[model samples]
Target: MISLIAADEVPQPAYSSGVMLLIAAVAVGALLFLIMKVKLHAFVALVLISLLTAIAAGIPLGDIPAAMAEGFNTTLGSVALLVGFGVMLGRLLEVSGGAQILADTLVTRFGEKRAPLALGVAALLFGIPIFFDAGLVVFLPIILTVARRFGGSVLLYALPAAGAFAAMHAMIPPHPGPVAAAEALKGNIGLTLVVGLPLAVITWYVGSYLVSQFLGKRFHVDVPDVLFGEVNDGNDEDEKAVLRQPSFAVVLMLLLLPFALIASNTVVATLGASGAIDAEAGWAEFLVLIGQTPVALLLTVLASVAVLVRPGRMAEAQSLMDGALGPICAIILITGAGGMFGGVLRASGIGAAMTESLGDLGLPLLLQAFVIATALRVAQGSATVALTTTAGLIAAAAAEANLSDLRLVLLVIAIAAGSTVLSHVNDSGFWLVSRFFQMDEKTTLKTWTVMETTIGLTAFALAAVLWPLG
Candidate 1:
């Protein structure tokens, strides 16, 4: 029933299980070694390897292009706009000094003694409408500022804040990782959002905030001077960009708007499904229509711009929105390539191969999702790629496995959590965190790596605990 993934479309494989497995291993190994050792661009490596994987799997050569295109187009159809709007919103907030305002407000509310927690809380709030990389970029100045004034390990503030972004991005919809996974699995996106937000917050608190405070003491890191003095860094421009600082309430409202709309949609759908509301009623139709994640997020972006823009500077706001799309183009394309690779693997019978070997073991569906996602994440270094790929691989099995809708959604969460594990040298995020905090490889491994692993495991554990209840 999956779009573009009919069972009848899958070609009969000529390769033995051992050969198919070998091809799979070689495909993944080549992808990693090229991206890491040979220094190939990730987008190129993913696309090239996907085409090769299709050929090796014995698909007719002419059908290969269609397979890749279906995967790429399907993934981008859901992911591109959410990311586009989200990044635009983030750019506006960052360029307008709203991020600084938000951070300062957080510190004021929490007081200096608990400033680390405050920055983390701010990041958590700011992170809802933002991706990890973009959110961290905006928050870096504030994190550095807090670290400078407070005089302690940068990790004290940085880890919790960064971890908060990571947690939200990994678990929540409109972040692409979980969303693409849900799409591939044909699970309920609205239900995932409704169910996911609470779980994300709980897991972030236990996995990121508490764990961060522990690791903060052990791994002391000095805030780097990199962004402090650079003219183009926007540290100076951002301060004078705004006529007056935006109120914390305004920022908070914008961040929460999308979630509220998405939640309302989920609520209405649940009520209608349970016969609390007439499914055919106009109210139900309206709620479900506006409540779709893309529509909600898009509306949020539009509403934020209206509220956040200085009256005479609509043009500048327009520029910020336009500027936002360019930086994320690479990210969007790479994410599609990941989806393409996953599609190829699916067409090749990797999922069936796995089911044949492991399905008889009676591993809980949630555990299997986590294990597969974690392996792909560690091997490849892209969480979105790992997530989308794993979801595609397991899509057929998920359909045939007799899982409920809610369980399928939770399975997506489990996959997302798995994708968050063990960010090492292979991951760009590892280097991003390391360079930003001025930590060497060893320290980054000790600190950032540990925090990432904790977030993934904790999120997965929480999802597992919730599965039976579902």
Candidate 2:
């Protein structure tokens, strides 16, 4: 969503709309072949193809590197800090046994018969402030332990929790995809979180939880020994940390800390914009500053270390947070590269061409947003890239529509839904789940891919239904 070129600075088209569209198609095709077939790293593939696409689209050679860097830097300016801090919080929670505390309490409250539901509920809460990959990694041991105790397919315990994280990551803020999409589209971050939270829960319950029940019946995947080995076969006490684990109340409070802060800004800013409050008041300005997404998360992280970590274990806590950073470096870079690719498309006038073509097709803008995102997702395999590129493709039309903030957020939801569907071999997350669960490609296709499609369709259905109200 970052604009590399100002409105008046937009260059004249070098080719006809049809030709530019064709060039974009070919660029996407090459990008796919490189990543899915050649097994090139996504970061390398993105940067390479971005350069090539710029050349093919007739961007001046002199401006290409700056264009790429501008796109990359602008996106990272918003994404890296949030993702880094969120991952740090997640690691602190994971190593401190916070995930175990939440799952244990929830399962006890729900009783043994509804253990899967309890795990899902815990994941939904944990996922709000953490990225999908981080939350999933933290919960793997708990899911396996519960599945082993209850005696059923691991799918029963795993799918619901995984789906919850997926739903939140795709639709909610703080995670890079939706965060970047919100920034690109100029949507209200607070409102996107406000509208997206309940929609995600509903989408997960219907598309994921229910569908998981059906899949669990048909696909009986035994718990794998790959990660934990015979340790999972032993007592829960074996895996407990040496330190006294934090209570559920403390863990839940930590998770909700950012939400309370961010929501205050959203509420106050809305009231101020509508002339319901003194917009220029000192208190209002201070609330907005502390409520900034990165600032809120930063405050939460500091509070977590103080409350959750023992005074003597500061070094251990620091080490855990440092470990979290190493894994996310690739994710951050790939996201920045995705922004660069989208920027190139915009700079080359391909985005304008895409806008004109969508208009010629006469499809409603919401439908257009979903379909384009879906196609990009199915082709390239990275949801982040699809969401980023699709936002750029439609940003021109969205700006011209003069829509309200609510409608803009709905468009982001639609785009996210399109990106969420159709995960396959090319997606790293697919491989992560496949390896963790020890499922073959065929089984993964049946379970993960199908569940993803349902989630996407369900989200789009809700967004479409809500479009009129927006």
Candidate 3:
């Protein structure tokens, strides 16, 4: 029957449980050491470790190549297209002035007095369709300008935006992490998004605003010279020309279209099952199928290129594509490698052993998720790694736990929370914040690390509450 192992039971492969666990730990540790200490590319490190794992577990020589190939091809097949299209979409938005338009529109509506709220909204809205790092770089100049004008800490504005981005980036589907988690756990993407949106709002306000308020007061440091280096003095004609432009309503609609379609499809499908709507309608089925995550993202990207690109903006569009693709290449490779790592673990029976060990501990699924995610997050600096690894470990456990769909969704959030905790020297996000804001390691630890922990803990608490209700 080619049965996958359940969480409560360990599969008996050719190797002993102890031997499998030991080999898995060593493989994971080697990958971490190579990546974090030796500065190897995560993709290479993962592939190397996958082979080492196969060897240590005595996986047949012939099967190893097939396993690696299958893992790589399967993951890239599902995700590479969406990621490539998504990168292009984000680039078009950036070059077409869509991001600036959204930022300016929010600032105008909210006024200078509520810039934080505006920044948060901007992050939430724009972040949905773009990578968090891309979103940050695209809008950093405006965020800096707002901070300079407001006479407060830049993080007073920046942190809220970051929080919103983090929440959506981790929690929502179509994003690589959430999408990977949904696929791994076999959960419904639409329901995950429906719950994730509200949770994201709560996390942003509480984690970003409240935490930043205290951190900003305690740090009270000036913006570093590196960050404010030779500010353009407001006379750059080209830069000025791009500001306050683009159609706000059109950009907003484009951003929301995919999400609205997906959400509406889920609602209709659910209600249809309860006899609230006709499930057999051609339009209903079409909407549901089109709203599938991959299709929606593809459609959005195509529509964005058509709507956002002006006739003369080819150079701008090219630049945006270059910029977006440059950063995403690393992410795409790492994510693909992580997928292979998971697949190798499954093939090696490590996932089954880990699930059995956790079941033996009698831990709640939420707590199990938290521990697994937090452990991986501490070991590796990548949240994507933590989320993917934890999801793989818990997939069996979740099924054995017989969790409701809502509880399974909450488990995804819990894994996100655990992955978010304690970002420090090992974490790249810490360094990114430190470099961009020109903070010393210590200050970055105090602000960015704490902010991440706050987001993680807040998300965990919310997940805990929601888990029981589910």
Q: Which prediction has the highest TM-score against the true structure?
A: 2
For candidate 1, write residues 423-450 as lDDT tens digits.
8644556655765576765687789989
Number of the predicted model whose lDDT against the real structure is largest = 2
Model 3 bad stretches (over 4 Å): 1-18, 110-245, 272-280, 311-327, 362-456, 459-470
Q: Return the candidate ranking by lDDT, descending.
A: 2, 1, 3
**Residue 457 accuracy (lDDT) in model 1:** 93
Candidate 2 clash pair list? 1-184
Q: Write the per-residue lDDT of candidate 2 for residues 251-352, one digit (tens) a residue.
A: 788867776786677667767876999978999999988877788889988988888666576776677678777766766777677667766776677655
TM-score, ranked from best to worst: 2, 1, 3
Candidate 3 lDDT over residue span 312-375, tens digit each: 6657655656665565555556555655665566566664454445556767779988877775
The candidate with the higher TM-score, 1 or 2, is 2
Candidate 3, residue 357: lDDT: 54
lDDT, candidate 2, residue 39?
A: 81
Using lDDT as the yardstick, the better of models 2 and 3 is 2
Which regions of candidate 1 fall more than 4 Å away from where they truly are?
A: 1-14, 111-244, 361-470
Better of 1 and 2 by lDDT: 2
Reference-based lDDT, residue 412, model 1: 92
**Deviation from truth (RMSD, Å), model 2:** 6.5
Q: Give the TM-score of candidate 1.
A: 0.66
Residue 95 error for model 3, in Å? Answer: 2.5
